[model samples]
Target: MSSVLLFNKPFNVLCQFTDDLGRETLADFIKNPGFYAAGRLDRDSEGLLVLTNDGQLQHQISDPKHKLPKTYWVQVEGQIDSTAIDKLCKGVVLKDGLTKPAQAQATSEPDWLWPRNPPIRERQSIPTSWLKLTITEGRNRQVRRMTAAVGFPTLRLIRTQVGPFKLDGLALGQSQLIKQTNLLK
Candidate 1:
């Protein structure tokens, strides 16, 4: 039998269960004895993270070959226009290569968005809007970098879903044991 854990990772919390630098980590939230993260979420980002005790299950969930789409609700520092959406959907060119075509659309801010403790930096002359994007690949800082590449730097990032699982009822720093029976193709 395999076990899956769903965590609503809070902003600035290291994704790792352990941290050598004495920084806050998943340990502060998750006390499961044998579980491990499937993929890492950056310290600045928040929302759904998956963990599993089995190596093969973890690999299956995180490997890009599975084509599991991760959805992110992004607040960026500018009015996002259709041009940006078109570029993102067409696959923006990055230093590495052209990113796989992704779904990018502007959306209203989510209902339960909480204020970050210290909050994101704001410029007197700049404005920002929320956008939702879904992508199949998980690259280091990919969402932030992709948005920045199109002249809109991400101010806050919240991953809302990974495949069929989501941060549905979870709040900041909350977690629950998710039964494998609920997993979807």
Candidate 2:
């Protein structure tokens, strides 16, 4: 059986097990050896990060070709409108080329959300809104870049789900071992 760990990564934590720069890493939260992160979340983003001992399962989860959609809850600096949502859903043109159409919707900030350390900057003059976005491709800073392309800069980003696994019930820096059967789902 493969050892699958579902971790709720906190903001500023590096996705790797170790960092030569002495930053907080998976090692700080997970003591279990031989497990590796299936995908990466940027240091500024927070939430569900999958770690697995099975290399095949890791590839299936991380590879974009598999099209395992990852969902994120994002807080943007502006009051996002339907047009922006439409653009995101219709595929926005980015410097790296046009992104594939994604599931994007304006949402209210989740009441159950944990407070981020070094909280996102707030401006007195501008309003902020939340969005729930799901994308199959995991490009570097894709969510942030996508929102920016539509004129709403992301203030906070949290990945709520990846494939069948979710960050629900996991606290910051907390982790739980998932059954292989659940992972297969």
Candidate 3:
């Protein structure tokens, strides 16, 4: 039987199970052997990270061809307006290329959120706002770049959901085992 583990990765933790640099990794939090992360969450970002023992399941989650929608709760450095939101929805051109159209909207900070260990820098002259964006493709720092391209640099990024799985009910650094069937389309 295949086993899936939904982890609420804490900020500053590496996505990999092992690290040569002595950085905090999934191994520090998860002891389950033989499971690997489906996709990577940057050390600076935090939230739901899926791990599985099945290669097929891992591929399905990580492959861009699957077009599994990943939702991010991004806190940006400026007061995001509807125009910015629209631009993000329409897609933004980055150094790599134009990104696929994404679903984006302004939102209040999530109530269930835990404070980052070292909180984001705050500028008294500038304000910040939150946005929820769902994108089908996973590019390197794509969400951060997309927001910056629209003139709102991302201060904090959290992946709240990936396809059918979510970070709902999970606390920081917590993990729960789930059946693979729960992730089926």
TM-score of each: 0.96, 0.97, 0.97
User: Per-residue lDDT tens digits of candidate 2, residues 1-185?
Assistant: 88789999999999998899999999999988889999999999999999998998999899989989999999999899999999999998989999999999998999889999998999999999999999989888999999999999999999989988888878889999976554666
Error of 1 at 140 (Å): 1.0
- What are the per-residue Cα lDDT tens digits for candidate 3 across 1-185? 77889999999999997899999999999998889999989999999999999899899999999999999999999999999999998889999999999999999999988999999999999999999999999999999999999999999999989988899989999999986564655
Of 1 and 3, which scores higher on TM-score?
3
Top model by lDDT, which number? 3
The deviation in Å at residue 183 for candidate 3 is 3.0
Query: What's the candidate order when arranged by decreasing lDDT?
Result: 3, 2, 1
In the range 121-161, model 1's lDDT, one tens digit per residue, is 99989988999999999988999999999989999999989
Give the Cα lDDT of each candidate. 0.90, 0.93, 0.93
Q: Which ranking of candidates, highest TM-score first?
A: 3, 2, 1
Q: What is every candidate's alpha-carbon RMSD to the true fold?
A: 1.2, 1.0, 1.0
Model 1 bad stretches (over 4 Å): 181-185
Off by over 4 Å in 3: none
Looking at model 1, residue 147 earns an lDDT score of 99
lDDT against true structure, model 2: 0.93
What are the per-model numbers of colliding residue pairs?
A: 0, 0, 0
